[model samples]
Target: MKLHVFDTFAYSKTGKILHFDVLLSERNEVKAHQRAIEWLDSIGEQGATIKPRGCTFCHTVADAPQFADEVARNGYAIYKLEGCPA
Candidate 1:
């Protein structure tokens, strides 16, 4: 499967910046942004919003098998790159 990647960044309540990538099977910027926010919320970043310039189309790539299952279940998969809570 091919996945569209959206590089995203959001600031936590403590003002810590979080950087991650949202990967979706379809190429939809709106959905990508929504997923990014949803992920932040799930990680306890309630009410977090992506920076105006934070979410941008990065590239499309072939899916890694591990991510396929997650994409099938969640419609998107997150690749946390930095500033995320372990």
Candidate 2:
């Protein structure tokens, strides 16, 4: 599994620095949900809110909800901004 991280920062309308991060990856999978989780974990081993995709098979999971459900409904799991497990 190959992982990638993105250095990012967020701000509020009042110019308040919301958060700064040098996101890192602990793992990578061909699956989209898994990959997204890996991304969130890299920063601090956390979970993230995931948006399901369309027809596309990933090593980690199936295509997505709409499409994936059509084919492998019980194959993959979906979530959005879920906290990481310790």
Candidate 3:
């Protein structure tokens, strides 16, 4: 059961797409990946500024690459965090 944490972050460039990091633990890997995808999809369905693949949550970024890379190396793909456009 691997646990994955999702955090969000903004890029240095202006108008750059938002970014997010998905953290993963060996025990919650499978569920975390599934949840990550689901969360993205949910965000997208709402017609969110950022699409599922593009938008990310704050938690995903606060932790950072180290938090998500672990999951990526295993199998889960990372989603770049895009903020809710105003």
Candidate 4:
């Protein structure tokens, strides 16, 4: 599973991401989407602000029809880990 990387600095600048998240769903797109929404709701309780891909920082894959479509493409967060070597 590969998650498209999000720029931490950019996230900070945009004030869009309050916490980092990584999700792994079954290979099925429908289940993946359901999990994504759940993650959003669950983390939102903790003030984590993550959206599928349409929030405000999806320039990388603008051609994607929607954020759920983006999530269905991979089994991870759309953003990369903050301190890992990508």
Cα lDDT tens digits for candidate 1, 1-86: 99999999998777888999999999888899999988988988997768787988899998578788899999999998999888
Q: Write the per-residue lDDT of candidate 3 for residues 1-86, one digit (tens) a residue.
A: 34445453333334444455555553343455465555455555222233343323233233445435545665554445455332
For all candidates in order, the CA lDDT equals 0.89, 0.32, 0.44, 0.38
Model 2, span 1-86: residue lDDT tens: 22222223332334432222221122222444444444445545343333333212323322233433322433323332223233
Relative to the true structure, candidate 2 reaches a TM of 0.24
Q: Which candidate number would show the highest lDDT if scored against the true structure?
A: 1
lDDT of candidate 4 over 1-86, digit per residue (tens): 33332322213233654333333323334443444445455544333334454232222432334445555765445343442224
TM-score of 1: 0.93
Determine the backbone clash count of candidate 1.
0
For each candidate, how many residue pairs have backbone atoms clashing (under 3 Å)?
0, 6, 23, 0
TM-score, model 4 to reference = 0.29
Which model is ahead, 1 or 4, in terms of TM-score? 1
Error of 4 at 60 (Å): 21
Off by over 4 Å in 2: 1-30, 54-86
lDDT-best of 2 and 4:
4
Give the TM-scores of the predictions, in the order they appear.
Answer: 0.93, 0.24, 0.29, 0.29
Q: Best to worst by TM-score, what's the order? A: 1, 3, 4, 2
Off by over 4 Å in 1: none
Scored by Cα lDDT, where does model 2 land? Answer: 0.32
Q: Against the true structure, whose TM-score is highest?
A: 1
